[model samples]
Target: MNDSKLECLLIRIDNFSINRTEILLCIHFEISTQTMLSQSNLNLPGITQNVSKVLTIYTGGTIGMTLNENGVLAPVPGQFEPRIREDMNFHDPTYLPQEPEWLVLPSLGDEKRVLYKIKEYDPLLDSSNMERSDWKRIAQDINDEYKNYDGFVVLHGTDTLAFTSSALSFMLQNLGKPVMVTGSQIPIYQTRSDGKDNFVASLIVAGTYDIPEVCVVFNHKLLRGNRTVKVNCEALDAFNSPNYPPLATMGVSINLNEIYINRPPLIEPFSVQLSMDANVSLLRITPGMTLNQISGALSASVRGVVLQSFGAGNIPSNRDDLLTELKAAIARGVIIVNCTQCLGGSVADAYDASSEIFEMGVIFLGDITMEAAYTKLSYVLSKHAWSLQDKKDMMKTSLRGELTVKSAKLNTANRLGNVIVMEKILIQNSSVVNSAIEEAISFDQTKVIELLLKHGAQLTRPPLEVAESLCAAAARGSVKRLQSYQTAGVDLSLPDSSGRTALHMAALHNSVDVVKFLLNHVDDINQRDILGLTPLEYALRNQSTEVIMILNQAAKS
Candidate 1:
């Protein structure tokens, strides 16, 4: 083919992705009967499919509910079971079918069809009424049913769904089976309800995908069950899996997004704790919160208090009276948990009054979300009337994946906790990597994103840490780390903590790939860092051709 024709074809394929029709013609350039017929279906909407082997467990939701005579859109008790038995059509689950499903795709001859039968289960409820007792029962039921099915689809109410999910992530432990919870805002019977897509996608997702953990499928998004929190009370996409990436997401095809899956041994067995013992209290400090209010909440027989501290865990510095009462509460065996008032900060016990409270006996909740604090504390407190050794174990350990252990900022760290401290460890541990900055330079493609992200760049993340990684990577001249940054979406043109991009860092050290990746991504060829030296200026002054080649490529791009 001529270059022009090939380019046109490439453009067309890019614009409208190469379907089987396009693929057949591009590869063979001949029309056959099968290819032509297959092409015909590509544009068709809503084709009823034959899901021959998958099981759809309908536990009731807006998907199976309708408006009663009183006009409330509610689950019609046993309606979910009949809907499945009546062959009421729906799409397959998000992931493909499983067995007791394994990680691999089904055998080629295995049914392109689904075998959905009405689960011979009991009635479903709107999740608002879901108590911890109900959660215990649901976990038990799913555990019992897991071995016999291809996958499970739970129709849950949007409200309180997060709580049930967090519970299941811990309760079920390591499920090789895919357990999915989903629901809709509008009733499935309503003309414009999002029920069909949400329900069908979750069903297909549960059956087809290999993420073997509890998850919530809603509004075309698949959230890791433990990490997710229902943020909106009324929207269709009500949940956000805070501090975690989605395990998978729904689209034309299910996109499984998990980078890793942590599982305990199934031989370990599924046992229900059934209770948590945390008598938690939340104290919201305003301009004039006095000792009286603090004493009232702490003295009210509460075993725990989530002291909502101000900036980085600060409070009124002069209010020794309130601080004294708080200390007394701590002496009363009250587990005071200090969480920052700022949405993004932590309680340092060094800032304002927050530190004094921390000194008084409050444990740092760090950046955990407020909804999580309430539910987790409630669940923990409910485990028993008293905080036992086991209850403390739950808090320190990440039960339900709610807390971070390693003290690093999230998404940037391969693990959690203390970004600065973590970076030094990641880099210093790079015996092969030699430096933290060299975190991702090994691969030409793929894992580069994860590596560079693990190395971390900045945007509101503290500068003291970035300076350390920057100095370390620059000192080592790690090519792999540089390349990884490109894939990880680092804006190469931007300045670092010391006012240098990798360009300037490369010029100082004469790194070829580092300079090359930087120049490729940075728009300004002659850009300078805070030191006012363009990378080219440094390359020329240093007289390194390798560094010069990198600068040239960056300039050309």
Candidate 2:
């Protein structure tokens, strides 16, 4: 093909709307497919290979808006795509002319090309106008195209972006793909807009990585959607995950903090839960909050309330009327959750003023953002089939990495006060008793383990994991920790996930004291593992003569 003809075809593809019919017309040109593919002066070699598809859900945001006649910025539909297409940073016109549905982007040295299609919303809304209905719509759209795309990016206004992101985090259950929410404080049309970078980075991360989380990608940080809060109105980095770490950081390279990312559930199928009950409210407590004001905040129609309490979840303990109104709300089955008004720190019953509220059944979520608490309440309350207690329990737990769960037993251990008081607290929080027992045993806190056991906390976890815990204790030569578990009725002969007994770990780690202790408790001193190796053999292989001597003597006996 002639250079002029090739140039003509490239310009035609660039000018036209990306659709299949237009692509077919390009293919009908007299040149061969190979000839068309060879004309590449765009610095990308093999641009068609290693492609990832994303569905960009352009719900109206500051990024897509242009200034109106009144000089105020407003979202204008059908304007975003044209602007980005004109900017070569977002679209590469030379990529696969016969397949125009894929809006190809230039490779970012990661050897992956992102081909995206914009699904802009009609009658675009400022995120201030977004509600539960909007969250449901976005979630449902992602669900509908879940199979067709590698990931999703929702462009939204930064005003209520965190709330929308939080709602989507709950509504989109068992999400196995990245769903990134991002927007700019500045509009894309402006000369100094941050939208271009935010938009491009979101696309790259959503397409390139397997971070199975609902993330908010803005200002070079990928934050957990539910964990985020709009911290600053004027700054480019508007959102912050104060309690949690960002999932990925966009910089010289797209660096992912793999440990913080959620592993996609293998058992549960991806689902969209549209039934979010929006009849939830927030009550930020002040010093002089009257009974009538409290009652109005916890309205009759509201099913749940996120009480933004003072530092460390405190309330005016002297105000009997205030306490009475809160008690009345809880009595009527209102799921009241206590979240701190401070930017950082958890809502704890550390103060005397916080005690009455806790006794009255206000669930304390540690360091959870107000946006997350409110949306979580809505999500939990929407479950019509769940019992009242079950819904309340769900709120207390970190379902979507929303809160840092400070266990009741751990809290009690941190403040080792009167046994009677500790027992009362632990007894009431039975749901986390087993977990607390494990934590205590791991730390070799014998007294805490005993306290939990007295309250019916048992080693009732999955048998394989329990075995591993015992083996880990044995390997560390923590006789006290092992003794606590054994005294709590744990079978000393329990095998780990690898089918190796605690004796195997103790022998391999050269723990002579642990070896001696296990010899008296385990069913057999010479038990064979799944690999057909006995503890004596493991000790001999590891060349631990003391453990070897102990095993040899035990074998003789």
Best model number under lDDT: 2
Instruction: Give the runs in model 2 whose Cα sits over 4 Å from its true position.
Output: 1-48, 264-266, 407-460, 463-557
Candidate 1: Cα lDDT at 187: 75
Query: What is each predicted model's overall lDDT from 0 to 1?
Result: 0.58, 0.81
User: Which digits, one per residue and each the tens of the lDDT, describe model 1 over residues 1-557?
Assistant: 45775665466456554466545444332122123223212222333442323345555555677778997776666665444433335423333333322222222244234334445235576666776677777776676665445566676777777777776666665465577887788877667877877766766666555556777888888877766777777777788865666767667666664433433311123445555444566887889976678777787588777777777777787887877777887676666676666645445656655656656666776656555565566667666654555655565565555665443532344333234544565566543222323322322233433543555532333444444344335434555444454455545455543345556657756666566555555677676543345778767765777777766765675
Candidate 2 lDDT over 1-557, as tens digits, reads 67886776666567655566545544442242222233222234455456777899999979998889999989887888888878888888887665665577886775577889999899899989998888989999999998677789999999999999999999999887789999999998789988988999889888877777899999999999999999999999899998888888888887877546654312145788999897888889997867778888888998999999999899889989888878998999999999999988788988899988998899999889999999999999999999999999899887988887766455546235345665776767677777777555554556667777888888777777768668767765668767877877789888754457889889877888998898889878878754456899878866888999888888888
TM-score of 1: 0.57
Worst 10 residues of 1 by lDDT: 30-39
* TM-scores of all candidate predictions against the true structure: 0.57, 0.69
Looking at model 2, residue 488 earns an lDDT score of 71
lDDT of 2: 0.81
